[model samples]
Target chain A: MGYISLDQARTIIAAALAHGGQLGLKPLSVAVLDSGSHLIAFERQDGSSTLRAQIATGKAAGALALGLSSRRIGEMAAERPSFVASLGTIAPAGLIPAAGGVIVVDEAGRAIGAVGVTGDTSDNDELCALAGIAAAKLKAQNA
Target chain B: MGYISLDQARTIIAAALAHGGQLGLKPLSVAVLDSGSHLIAFERQDGSSTLRAQIATGKAAGALALGLSSRRIGEMAAERPSFVASLGTIAPAGLIPAAGGVIVVDEAGRAIGAVGVTGDTSDNDELCALAGIAAAKLKAQNA
Candidate 1:
């Protein structure tokens, strides 16, 4: 299975944090996970809340667990709250049905990893996550 | 980051139990955790509930996870029940929004550890936690 390297994970976190900074967003937290949903790297800005670590990890790991971006998971949640809530109970990392979690894919469109970001509006968080993936020259699953 | 030592953890647990005894409170449980929310030491007095161990750890670990005392979390839960409930799903050690959880801080105001107490009322549980921290000559967060 395709996997994310530690170096790539670090690069994603750095770029994500930088993007959030340039946008004047709140202190952010980022987490990167390999295809198997194991954390490769994580960082939370100094002023970020304590739960940022788990939230970030949940976003990315949740995306991978369901084979969809968290944005889509969020939509699914809106349509089927009970189903989604049940999934959260079974998902080891817990599923966060929100935006800002994006799967990274290789040239062949095979998922390699995921990145999750939090600290601002969900839209802004997703923007930073995408920026990080782009800066690393990685392809987002559907982009 | 500052962390709690085994000796200090033991001290905190012992003192908390003693305080509970002196106050004529019900059989109590105490837990001490390092900065990373890892358990350092734990104890349960005779006749304590079967779930006292998990409850004690949940209080302390939840405080560390949210960067706030469990009392504050309880307040937040009152105001934002759904938000706090979602967090509990993602939190690894579980988040219990009740009293008896206190974060230990260093002179610089950095979190070093946490103490949790449980048995009688939440108020009484918190009192013993404070007493334990005092006995250990450690500072409680915001104190």
Candidate 2:
């Protein structure tokens, strides 16, 4: 299985931040994680809230843990809140049922990594993640 | 059960790191925990992954929780995946189900504490834990 390199992680973060800036969104936080949900890189912009780091990492890690994007996880949470809540307790990085998390896929559609962005509307955050992935020339699974 | 002192915990960490260096392994993180599974000391080398600290602690804490080495827990996970996964939800530190966690024993063969190392291969990590325990003049439960 492929993994997200530190270089690609940095590029994702930079592009995500740039996209958020262009949209005039609130201070953003971005996290990139490998397939195992281990953090490769993370950055929270100035004035971002204290919990941004956890929230960002949680989004990406949660997506990887469940083999679904965080947006899909949010839908699952809506359908079965208790089941999703139980999983959050078990997940080491915790789970954030939101739209900002997107899985990065390889040529064969196997998950390579994930990216999560926070600090704006969930939809806006997700847009930034997509923009970042596009800038890095990586595929976003089911995007 | 006896507890590991802060001084001894530090010694374990230092010696573990020294051993990793001698072997030219990747950057490592070490955690020393008391009999109660409370952290006594921790150290993550520069350039180690972001989850190193949590993984290290989880290894040692998982050992204490099941009263077996983390290596054995990994075997249990392989044999009974769902059972081990369920326990991970209840475990506060989370169970990693991997090697590198070793339980330290007192003269009477009772558990005193535990040591966990991470960063390189699981076997290499376990070797570092063993080296640390020996350097501290402690005995591993099943070494």
Candidate 3:
């Protein structure tokens, strides 16, 4: 029963976009996914490429599925490209082992959801998502 | 600027499951897709088969891509099996020419989104989807 609310999702998205703008990043697409890796809400800022949404969703799905930040997934993929490629076959939406996917944890340290961003460099996208979660007074567990 | 909200998608899924329960149908999986055929929300009820989600998504994707109910697509598939089969190659998520997909139209007669249900017979699936859309006070444009 503990899940991200629509208002919370909206706040995360708005703050993510605002943070991206503050960093002078390109237009971003953000996706909020519940613990089940189901999309709760998504938004694409004006000027963002249409493919951004899919990238954002894939990042979030990969993070949630593995309970790790996509940045970490990227590192793992680097160590074993073939294995990571195989993971894509089983993962829905195809896992993107890239930065920008961060888990949204509740006060109890439970991962309630995740926020993924696409636009700028992977590090910058992760920065924006973390800033958004912090702005909402929530915990971002993808260190 | 109008689009299907997460709240509306949630309401539709809840009502769809409730309708299925009332009708004593089998376990169901429902998928809601935005007008662009992107997944907005999804739920697979307990006891539903693992394939239900994919089937539901394919059905909704087929309906949205064609701007018609999946039943109509099924009819077309029946008449021109080869052509319809070829369509699956290009269709995103692979089209399922079944009877359970229904488009959700707005008051302005624009297709806002779609709901697809799978579990019982395709007829029962379509019935549950339509009931859910009706409960949301939305239009189901499936003749």
Candidate 4:
């Protein structure tokens, strides 16, 4: 299986932070995960909420576990709240089925992982994640 | 620097699980940790008893914290039971000195992460952990 290097993970996070700043979004925490949904790197801008890390990781994990963007996951969860709730139990750490998680694809067109951003509006977070993936020269599953 | 991605962690766990099955060991719970001892991935096979997750995590934590295999920790504890008992109090969640935890090393022999397995004899668990690490082409610290 493919993996995301630490350098690449850092680059993606830096771009995400820069994008969020450029857009004047709130202080944010960004997390990048390998294709298996494990965290490769994470950072929380000063003044961001402590919960931002958990939220960001959850979003990335959800995206990778489902092979879909968190936005799509949110849509499905909205239609089936009980099922989504069950999923959270299955993944004790939690899985946020919302916007802000985007799968990162390698040049070979294979998803290598995901990036999740939190502390801003879901749309803004999603935007920043997409921006980061693009800045890193990786593809975003949805963006 | 090298790091263990979520994909690699999952692959390691899958291999460990398969090895356990081949040996007819009891249901198991496995955990993977980054170099910092942060969780990367985890799984608890169906039928594994409760607390297996915590046990697995503790084992991994102990290995990462001391740079020694859980088996070695157990051996040291055998000689100084009180010190090991004190360690448990310090950890709160309890850090078992038993086997089943191994550090994952990069090609350069730098430890990149750790894996912990629980649910069978400590020796058997260690065997599975070693198998998993080998399958991933990563070195196990105390196979």
Candidate 1's docking class is acceptable
lDDT by candidate, in order shown: 0.85, 0.86, 0.82, 0.85
Clashes of each: 0, 0, 0, 0
In model 4, the runs with Cα more than 4 Å from the true position are A107-111, B1-68, B73-96, B101-121, B124-143
RMSD of each candidate?
Answer: 4.2, 10.0, 6.0, 6.4
The sequence of per-residue lDDT tens digits that candidate 1 reaches over residues A1-143 is 56677877888889999999999998899999988888889999985556788888888888898889888887787677678778888989878777899999988888898999988877899999999998888889873
Regions of candidate 2 where Cα sits further than 4 Å from its true position: A1-143
lDDT of 3 by residue, A104-124 (tens): 887777888898898899999
For TM-score, candidate 2 versus 4, the one ahead is 4
Quick one: RMSD of model 4? 6.4
The DockQ-based CAPRI class assigned to model 2 is incorrect
How is the predicted docking of candidate 4 categorized under the CAPRI scheme?
Answer: incorrect
Tens digits of per-residue lDDT for model 4 on B98-134?
A: 9998988887777788999999999999999999988
Arranged by TM-score with the best first, the candidates are 1, 3, 4, 2
Interface RMSD of each: 3.0, 7.9, 6.4, 6.1
lDDT for each residue of candidate 2 in A1-143, tens digit (9 for 90 to 100): 57788888888999999999899999999999888788889999999889999999999988876667899989977864543554566577978999999999988887888999999999999999999888889999994
Cα error, residue B122 of model 1, in Å, equals: 3.1
Candidate scoring better on TM-score of 1 and 4 = 1
Candidate 3 — which residues are off by over 4 angstroms? A1-57, A60-69, A76-92, A99-143
**Cα lDDT of model 1 by residue, B1-143, tens digit:** 66778888888888898988898999999999888888889999988879998888888888988778998889977865544555689877778889999999988888888998888999999999999999899999972
- Displacement of residue B61 (Cα, Å) in model 4 is 9.3
Descending-DockQ candidate ranking: 1, 4, 3, 2
User: Residue A32, candidate 4: how far off, in angstroms?
Assistant: 2.0
